[model samples]
Target: MPPLDSVLAGFADAFTLFNLLFVVAGVAMGQLVGAIPGIGPVMAMAIAIPFTFTLDTLPAVSFLVGIMKGGLFGGAIPAVLINTPGTPDAAATTFDGHPLAAKGKPLKATKMALYSSVTGDAFSDMVLILASAPIAVIALKLGPVEVCALMIFAFAVIAGLVGDSLIKGLIAALLGLLLATVQLDPEQATPRFDFGYFQLYDGVNLVAVAVGMLAVAEIVRRMAEHDGRPQPAAVPQSEEPGARGVSWREYWGCRWTMLRGALIGTGLGALPGLGSTAAAFMSYASAKRGDPGGVPFGEGNLRGIAATESANSAVMGANLIPLLGIGIPGSVSAALLISAFVIHGIQPGPLMFRTQPELVYGIFGAMLMANLCNLIVGQLSLRAWSAAVKAPASFIFPAALIFCIAGVYLSSGGLFGVSIMLIAAAVSLTLTAVGIPVIVLLITFFLGRRFETSLSQALTILDGDPRALTAHPVALILLVGALATGVWMARRR
Candidate 1:
């Protein structure tokens, strides 16, 4: 907590005028960038990073966090108006989000997105503040076998979420995991799929691949499908308060789903390495698996928006746990935030608690303010932004592709990144054409390492007893779930 004294001293400078300006500027830039497809927080942060060199640590970090908040919400913009995702994490948002807009409820969808996102984010932050230690304690007990099975469960759940077919989702997920494996073999130092390229020695960068497959690929596909059709102009619209007349009744109507999504996001977010994208996949899967009301998830279901938004939003807060408690960045953005700290000569970890309490708390306080800021700004502009739907996909898409190319290239200063983007986009397009679901692929990609690692650990701990999984409660539960899902699918078939 002692480090916090200096942090508090640092906080005292928030009123110094310059820091306040940076925060506003960062948020504005983030929103603008976020509205463009294929550019999210990562790209926003990269562009903003150069500017940080001109400022002190507190304002610099504050500015970055503010951009992050803006980027998170910006994804909803194009997704609702154009049906293209501004961020990879926002891909799921396109499902129900864009559909609702097409149905003349763009304002409603935007409002729901804001409320659900802020709700999930706020709750997750609270969990990080008050419940992270307890959750981490439980998470530490998980071993290799449990983790592997957990990955399998994640795979099953995600597969179940994508439309009506499990095969499609599983295939998509497996491909994603395979792509994820292209770079590094964690246990054995040998690369399995680098194809003799030194650029791949570090393995394929996830950001580049994600951008290529989701953002750039979408552009090419759009161009092929609709050649230069003029999109409609923006609609003049306004909302009651949220986005439409989003009533308290409506909010409470989906409260259970939102709360569940937040809980799942928080838990998954707390896991080291996995992040908001994974959180969205898993949360959607869980919603599908646990649904009692027979509502379709991918078809403009309000619950779907609530599910994805809440889970992904909560993931941000959950990512902070390992960062604050153990000095480990849970996601790339968190990793970037870590660098900002180190640049300022502030070391993170338990020692940080002793040294910079105010800075840490300042982050917490800023999170609250940032969410409020997002909500207020989101409500004000969500209606006007609906006009983007009027922009022809033909024009908007080329611009979107450019942004995607720029984002992937800027991730690292090399042309190889472009090559990877091409490869990923082609592969993703090929697979999707054959009916594979993206969420399925992403889950497999994320959990591939965790699966392999956990299985090996489980085996090691049990002296190679394959049946040892029966003794672990988590594993057993997963087994039961698999059995139930298999039986259900078979019956439906």
Candidate 2:
């Protein structure tokens, strides 16, 4: 470990007035973009990158980190309010958050998310500060074979947790895998399902797929149900103390759920390619398995919100571990941070610790400070978002639809993305109408490409030799676990 005095000095650097202001501004801006459909923190950070060129390195880096930490909570706002996930990872949040809102406890649901997000982020940041190097070393041992086996376990868990019928859930997951195959084959670099559309050569845009199925579909369904009628104004939560907010007792009650989520997220985030969306769903599935009789997993359960928010938020801090220790970008956000570091002439890796110890500790301090900022900013913004949900249904649905269209168009795919979104929305509605689990399908689709890439790489490495599996104990264990989980779930159902 670095000398105690150096750590203190680094923290002192982060406490400067300029750094604090940058963090605050970043947190506020992050929440703004995160609450809006399609404009997540990744895009916000990308836009803000050029602006940071004039600033000092610590403040500039802190600002971006603050934005990422804050977005974790902000993404849950719309998921809780209107059944629309502001970010793809927040899709899991919608399973129970929107149900709570419909039950007239929007404030309670949002508060649960806020508390869980901060708690998980703080836990992972502490882990990053103390044990990042060791964790990254362990994470490096997980090769393509291990990753493929892990994805199999994830799919098994999710299929069992999502819907009543195991067969239906598996079918939806298969469809998602099929959708992911539309892109050029990872190994061959040849298109399999593009159907001669040049635009599809790059495959379907994730923003379009996610926003369409989660946001546009819900908007269309609600509009059809109401038939243009104005909804009654939501009653003010202040009128009822018992139902308006989460209590300290309630937060304490979910301590185990949050801890499990944080652990799952940190572990997954340390590995490159596996992302927060998968972590969130995995945590949710675990929580559901532990609680067979409580709150039904998807119907206004506070623990559901806690599970997803904690896991996704934890991912942000844990993603930095590999970047700082091994110079490997664990996720897209970490990849962006790599550019920022390189622009400042700082190379990430073990040598940096000896050369730039103060800067490293300062980054750690900034992460801790960002967590506090997220809490304050998130609490302040809840009222504004709550009021939005209170607007008449006539106004809410129309505005949401407009945002969905605009957001998809502004995404990388442009007009083509918008078209894909419309089609995906229709498909989402059809699947829901037929009693299929849309969340399972969505999760599998999000993970399918990575799973395929890993499987192909694993196969190449093993050269079709069954004996080679013995050398990869981790992969063998994971594959066995996947089979066991599948059988366990099937029997339980």
Q: List per-candidate RMSD values in Å.
A: 7.8, 8.3
The worst-scoring run of ten residues by lDDT in candidate 2 lies at: 229-238
Per-residue C-alpha lDDT of model 1 across residues 259-338, encoded as one tens digit per residue: 98899888878765456777777777777777767447666677778888888888887878876764445565675575
Top-scoring candidate (lDDT): 2
Superposed Cα deviation of residue 150, candidate 2 (Å): 19
lDDT of 2 by residue, 256-307 (tens): 9999999999988876546799999999999998884768878988899999
Give the TM-score comparing model 1 with the true structure, all chains together: 0.62
Could you estimate the TM-score for every candidate? Answer: 0.62, 0.62
lDDT of 2: 0.78
User: Can you give the lDDT of residue 66 in candidate 1?
Assistant: 74
The per-model lDDT (C-alpha) reads: 0.67, 0.78
